[model samples]
Target: MRASLLLLAAVVTLWGAHWPIMKVGLAHVGPLWFNALRFLTGGLSLFLVVALLGRLRVPPRRDWPLLLSVGLGQMMLFGVLVMYALRHVPAGRSAVLAYTTTLWVTPLSVLILGETVSRRKVVGTVLGLAGIAVLFNPLTLDWSDRAVVVGNLILLVAALVWALCILHIRAYRGLSSTLELAPWQMLLAAVPVTGAALWIEGPHPGDGTLTFFLVAAYAGPLATGFCFWAVNQLTARLPAATFSNAMLAVPMSGILFSAAALGDLPSGPVLLGMAIILAGMATVVAAERR
Candidate 1:
């Protein structure tokens, strides 16, 4: 249990830091190109590790659908949406909104997957939206400022789409090791992401600075590759509710990391939103435990 806790913490920290890390990388490369490069690098890194461990293999035919969903829905769509959103949204706020996918999952599961929705989850869902509303601050917000509104809405929709992907993953039952499928999923997602990059973003600039390379390395290898592997390791040891709840910390940590790394300080409303979001997430976790 202690080991699981530590592993969970590490995963949360890695994911949290990724928001700002990605922001840094994007400063040096186009969003679409950066995503393609990072995922391609991550995929190859995972392939190397899995191959060294003698666990790498092609996924079976039936598994392709699940893999495709993960690649398309979770990887390509989610990454592209959030990356574009991050251009206009603050790193901390973007993290907060994106993490709302967890909040969306329960209600979505109940509605689409026919799973039961507890009263607590309903309350949690309400609190989560309230947090978003508060952060949105409609009373003072200029409706004409399309950038901010569009950025926030994109994040919210991305979170919902991500929830769908999570449901797809949860519904899959398979004999192939997750590690084995992981590289393929990355590669599958890479094809479209790369294509979009070529068509929309053209090629990355041939000359990248040291800072760009450093940020790319962190985003690709540590954030994407190792973070995925670490979470998979901890998942089997931790309770589902505990794991989900632990993820609530990721965005909060993202706020702090962004403040330090990117000098992104949250405004009062943002802070309040973060608190409320955490409270909502707590309620959801408690309900799941019950």
Candidate 2:
């Protein structure tokens, strides 16, 4: 009810803000360790919650591969790749690009998934991209800067992998609830993340500083764990259009949280871009309402 919505909102806000907080956190922790902590802590926390709620259950063996794909794609590919990419890019810029994938997902859904593109959805996609351009276009390679090249490339790949993961999940309509799959998938996904942290991150982990612990815990438990659980719970009752449409607010919240967290200022063009994006989202919401 009210509490669940607040939890989801808090989770999304933290996740959006995590883009910047991670920039600071990653400085102290290596890439693998950062991701390892993210998945491990959140996975374990959700494991307990799901178990207590009696929602943890494994699908049949035939379905194992697909479930594992979601885990690997999300936890290993998207999570790890973003961590590596963030090493090279600014937090705010990376946040903008990470979300800009709405543009890619729309067309891909049409071609690959055979989902028809309503004009409102198309408008939403275009405006979302325009917003991204305003927010992040200048952050790209310039006349003098080449340092973030690797990071930017990795982020692009991460976004595509995420779309793939999301599309893969969309193909699954009989999961009962996404929460029912979390403990299993998180457990399955943890094996690789642990090994990667061990092999790639070297011997040390981050010092248990107050800031590090808080940010890391929030990203894993509140953001990923509780958020996904909430998604499963809410979507079971709400219309897909209603549920999906709520995502339109995420980028705006991300930017607002960015300004609050980092004291980063959005330029006039960026603000205008955000407005256009909201207008597009409104169009989609309007169409869906009918």
lDDT of each: 0.76, 0.68
Candidate closest to the true structure, highest lDDT: 1
Candidate 1 lDDT over residue span 30-58, tens digit each: 88887787788889999999999998888
- How far off is residue 244 in model 1, in Å? 5.1
Cα lDDT of model 1 overall?
A: 0.76
Candidates in order, TM-scores: namely: 0.86, 0.87
User: Clashing pairs in model 2?
Assistant: none
lDDT of 2 by residue, 1-290 (tens): 46645755765676777777777788678877877777777789988987899766667766675567667876677878887877777676676666655655666666776777677766666666676677666643663656587677778787777666666666556534677676566666667877878887776778778888887877788766766556445544433333344454565676777778778777687688778777776777676656
Runs off by more than 4 Å, candidate 2: 1-11, 138-140, 229-248
Off by over 4 Å in 1: 1-4, 117-142, 205-207, 229-245, 280-290
Q: Which ten residues in a row have the lowest lDDT in candidate 2?
A: 236-245
Winner by TM-score: 2
Q: How many backbone clashes can be found in candidate 2?
A: 0
Error of 1 at 172 (Å): 1.5
